[model samples]
Target: MIAEATEMLLSHLVLFVLVLTRLSTLLMAMPAVGVGVPKRVRALLAITLSVLLLPTISNDLTSSTLPQIDNLIELLVAVAREALVGMLIGTVVQLLITGMQLAGELISSTGGMQLGDALDPTTRANMPALARMIGMLVTTVFIGLGGHRYMLAALMDSFQTMAPGNVILHQGMMDLVLHELSVGMSAGIRLAAPVLTALLLTNLVTGFISRTLPGLNVLAIGLNINAMAMLAVTAMAIGGASWIFSAELDVVFERIARLW
Candidate 1:
């Protein structure tokens, strides 16, 4: 009984090591949990969670001893495959957040608010204050909408559908990710359109004023008018941001759920 128990423990350990490789890779590349985090911390967290998950996911991998190969080359290849799969999924999610940042940039550009910047605590990088604000706002909405739980649920379900030994790249999923990226960029453009339109109209009016009022310093006057116009439009747009967020979140979740 003692020998049998020891053998079972060893088998579990082996399975855990394999499962951990994939989880670590995902945690390293995925957004929110991955970006700007210390590598050691990500590794520690991944190993700890993978250890907890091993028993649940072990069936997805081979329990039998590894087959003979040219040294450890094949084993390394398997590990690489697991890591690649994890990164692929994680990157898709990361790009989604990048889409949000791009939206922030477009707003800042059109609003004549690009001069403002702030340090982002979440990303630990210097970003436009507006961008940082939108980022934190999005993260808050994500939590409020229970998106994090869904992410974890997706991560857990992946083990069942994509075990270690049978790992294969899904080209169809990559295409879907590409489609989502393009859609996200378009959404950003749409979100910034109203403000941009207001700016354009303001410019046209300023140009006419310059031509008619020869005594006035039009360039100086136009700058202040542009600023005020942007402020007004931004305030108006903000009231509708929640609806935009809800619609965008629905699409994001729909795309994420299809990975399995």
Candidate 2:
């Protein structure tokens, strides 16, 4: 009887490890949770989530479908597959935030804000102030809109379909990722279009002024006008930007659900 109980406890322990692997990988890739979050805290959250999720994962498994943890090679393969699944989900959701940051980079390049580049604590990289600001704004909006909750729901549902040791890396998943990438790029361009247009017009007017009035300091005046135009257009378009991001985020979540 004691041996049977020991075997049961060992099986549960192995399942917990697998659940933790997937959860930790997913959480580490998430922008809201991973970025600027301490490693120790993330570890604790992963462990806590694993403990909570283990029972559900176990219930979902059948005796025949349980991963062959007794075999070292099979166990490693299962862990690897779980990590891949976690990364796929995380990457898909992260694309939305990347698109917003891309928009900010475009605006900065066109509006002379690139000069204010600084190290962003969240990303731990040098980024234009505008880009960093927009990244932070989108992240805040994501949390506010309960995107993180939706993300977790999607992860949970994925397990209902994609069990450990059964996550197949198929062409469909690759296509989905590529589609998200293209969408992100296009979305960035669309978000920055207004500012880009305003800056273009500002440049044209400044050029015409310089040609007609060679004595005027067109360079200095144009710089100030460009800055003002960028600020003004961005302020007016902020709401629209948020709307677009929110819509795109919804689409992202839907795609994840459909794929998984």
Candidate 3:
């Protein structure tokens, strides 16, 4: 009786560790959950989430159809596979979040502001101030809309669909990633289109004034006008930008589901 109980306990412990490998890897790759968060806190969160999800996935471990871990080598392989699956999903979500930063690049380009760089608190990376601000705004919207909740849900569902040690890598996965990246890039351009257009018009008017009044310091005047125009255009177009981000955030989870 004692031997049987010890065997069962070992099996459950092994299963829990396998599940944690994936969850911990995922938390390490995600933005708010990983980038800005302290390592200890992220680890605690991953462990907490793993415990919560263990019951739901426990049946998976007991299934006869599940892959057998015959030795230490097999267990290591399973751990690696699970980590890859989690990181893959996290990368896709990170790509979506970068759309806002791309839009900021577009807006800053016209103002000659993209050249100046600063440290971003969230990512701890150096980027233009406008890009940093937009990234923060998108992060705010992501949290506000419960995007993190949806992200966690999708991650949970992946285990049921993909299963640990069974993630298949195929051409379709690459195609999906490419398609999502294209969508993210297009979203950035669309979000910044209004501001870009306004900046273009501002440049043209400045050029016309410079030509008409050659004695004026056209360079100085144009710089001031571009700054003012960028501010105005940003204020006017923030609503549309938010809508684009929200729409893209919705699509990210759907794509993640299909990828697995």
Candidate 4:
């Protein structure tokens, strides 16, 4: 009886580690949860999540051996596969967020704020002030709308459909990713179109005024006018931006679910 209990304990331990590997990888790339979170806190969250998910994962491990390898080579290969799957899941969500940031970049470039770009904490890269604000705004909305919960649920579902040790980079996944890239670009354009249009009109007006009054410094006035127009247009378009971002995020979950 003791030997049987020991064997069961070992099996659970192995399954727990494998589950933890995937969870940790996914959480590392997750927005809001991964980038700024402390290592210790992230580790605790991964462990806690692993334990909670163990019940669902246990059934899949029944046929596999505890070591599941004849040597270290096979073990490393398995680990790489698990990490790849986790990374792929994270990448899908990241692409949607990237689209929102791209819209901000467009707005900033139109408004002349791209020159005033600074390092953004969220992405740890130099980004325009407007772009940073938009990224943060979208991220806040995503978290507030239970995006994290949906991602967790999706991870669980992936295990049931894809199963541990069965993940692969197949053509279907590639097609989905390509489609999403197109969607992201479309979303960025839609979000920035209103502001861009306003800026274009402002430029035309400034050019006409320059032609009418050659003495006036169009360069000096055009920049400020463009900046103001950008602010006004962005404020008016913010509601639509939010709707677009939310809609894209919803699609992210849908595509991820079909990955299996």
Ranking by lDDT: 2, 4, 3, 1
Q: Write the per-residue lDDT of candidate 1 for residues 133-184, one digit (tens) a residue.
A: 6566665666677765665666777667766545667786678679768766
Worst lDDT run of 10 residues, candidate 2, spans: 63-72
Candidate 3 structure quality by residue, lDDT tens digits, 126-153: 7788777777777788788987787678
Model 1 clash count equals 0
List the candidate 2 regions with Cα displacement exceeding 4 Å: 1-3
Which candidate tops lDDT? 2
Residues 1-260, model 2: lDDT tens digits: 99989988877777777778888889988877887689999999999988888888889999766665768887888889888788778887677678777888899988887778999765677888887778788888888899878878988988888876566777878887888888877877888999999999999999999999999999899999999999999898766667778888898888888897
lDDT score at residue 204, model 2, on the 0-100 scale: 98
What count of clashes does model 3 give?
0
Task: Tell me the lDDT of candidate 2.
Answer: 0.83
- Higher-ranked by lDDT: 2 or 3: 2
All models: lDDT? 0.68, 0.83, 0.79, 0.80
Q: Model 1: which residue pairs collide?
A: none
How displaced is residue 136 in candidate 3, in Å? Answer: 1.0
